[model samples]
Target: MDRTDADGLFPRWIAHRGAGKLAPENTLAAFELGWRLGWRAFECDVKLSADGVPFLLHDATLERTTNGHGAAGARTWDELARLDAGGWHSPAYAGEPLLRLDRLAEWALPRGAWLNLEIKPSPGTEAATGAAMARAVEALWRAHGAGESGGPAWPLLTSFQPAALQAAQAAAPHLPLGLLLDHLWPGCWAVARGLGCVAVVLNHGLWTAALLAEQRAAGWRTLTYTVNDATRAEALLGWGLDGLITDRVDALGPGQPATA
Candidate 1:
């Protein structure tokens, strides 16, 4: 599909890492909460375990989000699945297990929810993680009959690592890709263009009216991340942003008025 066709699949408001700060990030509970609050679009981090299982997690290490220690990628999925992924945030979510990508696809595809699956590879495993995630997502979506006539749109795969995105492109060229940028590094635009990305996701502060215009002129849809402030969201939307990934799901979402 072309840029316009792809743009239709992305929603105006995307819940960041599931329900953002409201629940444990990257957990199934977080996604459920976001869905209940009327968010149809979500962004989550995906990385491959040592055994090549693609799972939901943002950090390279397990210390922050889970009860496990050391590198998360070093453990196989069987070990990772036993960790209390939700306990770090609160007791109410204790014992919430790590989620596999297939499980997420199973829940999301049937609901027709849109997903921005960020390929957050661990250091030194960019290519492997990307390729693995692409293949896994492709299989999961195919099994659910996604991308068929009148079916849900395929998930958009995005990453800050060029090698990861490139590997994903090589593995599944039909999947939509987006380049994530925290800074406008030298040759970043060139890299994104070379990857044939349909969208460019940037830090909320990186956007300006001129930059937005420039990207749009080049036929690339522009989106920003973690925007929780109402005034900033209003400004970005007024500047014609294609999407906004926000943590404030309760206050800023579909049919909800933005408030400070």
Candidate 2:
């Protein structure tokens, strides 16, 4: 897609991990909360279960968010689905089951929500995770008729792992991809270009006026993550960022003023 095509597909404000810090991250409950709060674009992490089912999760282990132990990817979808994924956040969301990507697609596609699926792979499973997730997303979008006939944009696949993004590109070249970076690692830009990425998502602190200008000149969209402060958000927007993935869903969103 050209820049204009890409522009129509994405929004300026994307809710990080669904509802961000409000609800359990990467759950349907969080997504619903974001939707209610007027966020149409969302960014979430995706990994493949041992059974090859793609699901929403951020960490390699389940200890932080879910009531489970050990590697999340080690569990099959059947096993992972039974875990209480919300109680760690609060009592009201207790018993919220782990969400499969297909379920999320079923909910978001019909509603025209844009998604940025970050391919978060567990150790030793980068290639498998990327390939599986690409296939899953492709099938889901095809089934729902998304990104066609003027529907919602196709979900963007992003990752910190070059191997994973490479596998994704091989699996579904039609899908748009982005490279995630925490810093300007050597050869990172070259890798992103080689992978045919349309954008680059960076840590909020990594952006500068000069960097933004360079990226714009290079014809790549620029986005940053986890920005919650209104003052900082204002600065980034003023610098012409394409998007901001923020945790302050309740406070910062489309049409909401940037307040301190």
Candidate 3:
């Protein structure tokens, strides 16, 4: 898919984080685990390090997800990189390095995996994080020649924060964006159109056959997140869900099932 085309902005299925439930979430090991399972597309969160480089992390604080204890953005990549990011998940994954977005892009591009980069800023850094991440993505896209003079699929960026979405659009107007909404909002379609979003990602709870039909009928691609149950996933697929972000990529088929 060309970077300019929204038609192929997403993949059939997205592993929640590298391997979702199969490995420690958001670590390089987990991503590789997903790759091992024949999955090419995955979703991961990106947050700015203290020096503004984008790095993979799912929380504002590193305590819960990694052995490190502190605000993720408060520490420079050099400092955060030294901490054990995978030990808490299990002894088998003690030294998983913090994944730089640039490195992840390098790794994923060769294998043709579509990335869904969720911009998750620290509490007050929405605009900054959004702008920074957008700039970073733009630079990477340009460097990789992901523009019209392209090679492979550029990542699809999404976020629940409108400010972040706006910033991303401004930073790289050409890069496709998606609106991540947890519920049906008033004029939600209008909002997504205004932001130039290529897709609408809903919280798993609010999804239904009716809503899916409504969005699909309107020519909008719809996706759900964090779904882990096989039966529910099958049901969503039957309802014509465009895609899913799941954790159990290794246990499921090629698309990888949802993560909890």
Candidate 4:
């Protein structure tokens, strides 16, 4: 649970969408809620706005999660920012604002919370979006990374799209990257190696004890997704998983440091 090591091993409990189950997901309200609950690390989905700004959002369309409708990528950041991100989740969060990744970084950097920024593209913009996000990350790191002394304690980049991962590597080689997979693909390890990624994030169900063992032996860290049950978490820990991304941050209790 001690994440102070150089291996970029994750915190024991990661709040999905900035404490998704606790508050309006991907909003500042949710992140604040998680931080208040003593959860410092979180996972969030990011996509490029029409103007190329990175915003926190999960769905391809805005209708389900936000007060807007239509493809999220089709809108400019100005347009997206105007929507009420929290109202749909709950009336209590009616005025909650849309969160920008950079703004979140500014907030999280000083707090020692780790962030897993997932590169989510809008349709045909996969490579372009990835590159844009990578460039943004590069700038972010330049402005706030450890070497610069203004960044978060740890910043991790992840993507299911290989092109996006490649873009991140090209844009900022110093930052750690994680390859995401829902199912095992041919040469998955090789692909990860080629991208110079530090970890492989797998769908919880697709991974087996054997797969976990294999990935760990290869010197690649393993993290699973959306696990909310304590028993399941303990089981995965017994399997030697490096991290678990979950919607139930409250269920994790207080996590131990990675060095522990």
Candidate 5:
């Protein structure tokens, strides 16, 4: 598939976990806050609940963001839904519930927001989680993609787990896939190529002009995450990097030409 068109699918500056520290991460409130701050693109993480429902969340446990305890993947959607996802952030957001991926799709479908969905599988359920998440994404777009019901742009599916990315590829090859790397390693390029990924997301420290050139030379786009400083963001953009996922949605508004 010629996925070069996917290059134009995103902006240079993406809101990290939906406005990052501005609101409770991965909650609808966060995404809403990002939207209010002029973010047109966002990055998020997703995992399967005990009952196999896909939901937006980053950690393996719910203690950090929710009022619930124990492993997040150990609970059903109903049980997870009962948790207070925003109270831990502040009493101002006391009643936020676990955000389901489908519900998120519903919000984005009509709004034209671009999402970079990170396939964050639980420790032992990598393949299952990836397959399930991909299926849900495909179903959502099929029901809402452009010219069908006039949906927003389709999302880009990316992951750090090879098994997860592989399963997503097997389940939905038409969706743009990106391989994520926490650290640079030997044969990393081969791993991404093997999975048929069109892009590669890396930790900010791994970004370099040479690295960007190498990826470009091999016909792939390079993006980095959690960048919060202006100097580093400028340096990376100067290096010809494709995108920077940042927590500072406040500082890096979407109105700028680079972000536009």
Candidate 6:
């Protein structure tokens, strides 16, 4: 899809951080679980290692998600790669390896999965993280032949950090971008517009019918994050909200989410 397509290039139900707490967040197991649950599109967090290699991870620290200690970005890829990213969630997922960004692309593209790659950088390393991720994905997709001719869906890059988005745009202008918001502050639209973003991913509570229509008129797709309630999901889709990034794949009937 064209990077400028305002009609949007996302599935209606996007798996939040890949099935969201269903498996372990940001691990390959989580993504595979989402795909098995029949979700065509998945969202995930990405950050650069100390050596500049891109990898899947959500927090800036390793304690909550992995069997490691200290700052996540401070660790080299070799160190991060050895960490068991899944055991913290449950014993069933013990020994699941940390997923490299390229490794994920390899797995998902073959399975015909779509992605929302959230550029989650650690403090002060946002610029480098974004640039590296953009470069890595460019190489990844190009090798797989993603375009009008048919291959994988174009991955959408998103982030809550302006520096990361800015660096990504500079590095790979053709990739689709989304600006994630905890709240849509006064300057959020301008920041999104300036970055040439296709969407604004907001906290699910922030959307209103008027706001959705207003953003639609402005040519920006509106997506919500981490929603798990069935009633809210129905309401958002009914409101013409472009996408729902959620954890509750089961909230919709089986085979419902992927088709929605």
Positional deviation of residue 205's Cα in model 1 after best superposition, in angstroms: 0.3
- Candidate 5 stretches with Cα past 4 Å from truth are 1-7, 146-151, 256-260
**Tens digits of per-residue lDDT for model 5 on 39-114?**
8788999999999999999999988989889999999999999999999999999998889999998887678788
Over the stretch 1-260, how does candidate 1's per-residue lDDT look in tens digits? 11122438577888999998999999999999999988888999999898999999999999999999999999999999999999999999999999999989988999878899999999999999889999998899988887688777898899999999999999999999999999999999999999999999999999999999999899998989989998999999888888889999888867766521
Backbone clash count, each prediction separately? 0, 0, 5, 7, 0, 0
TM-score of each model, in listed order: 0.96, 0.96, 0.91, 0.92, 0.94, 0.94
Better of 2 and 3 by TM-score: 2
Clash pairs for candidate 4:
1-257, 1-258, 2-257, 2-258, 2-259, 3-258, 144-151
Candidate 4 C-alpha lDDT tens digits along 50-106: 888899888899998888999999999899879988888778988787899899878
Pitting candidate 2 against candidate 6, the one with the higher lDDT is 2
Supply the TM-score for candidate 2: 0.96
- What C-alpha lDDT do the candidate models reach, one value each? 0.90, 0.90, 0.82, 0.81, 0.85, 0.85
Model 3 spans with C-alpha error above 4 angstroms: 1-6, 255-260
Worst 10 residues of 1 by lDDT: 1-10
- Residue 250, model 2, lDDT: 88
- Model 6 agreement with the true structure over 13-95: per-residue lDDT tens digits: 78888877789888889888887877778899999899998998889999999999999999999999899988988999999
- What lDDT is reached at residue 56 by model 3? 93
Task: State the displacement of the C-alpha of residue 112, model 6, in Å, after optimal TM-score superposition.
Answer: 1.1
Question: How well does model 3 score by local distance difference test?
Answer: 0.82
Residues 1-260, candidate 3, lDDT per residue (tens digit)?
A: 21112466566578897898778888889888888778778899999999998999998999987888879999998998898888888889988878999988888877667889999988889989989998988887667767755577678889998889999888888887889998777987898989988789998888989988988887778888987778888888778787788876756547333322
Can you give the lDDT of residue 179 in candidate 6? 95
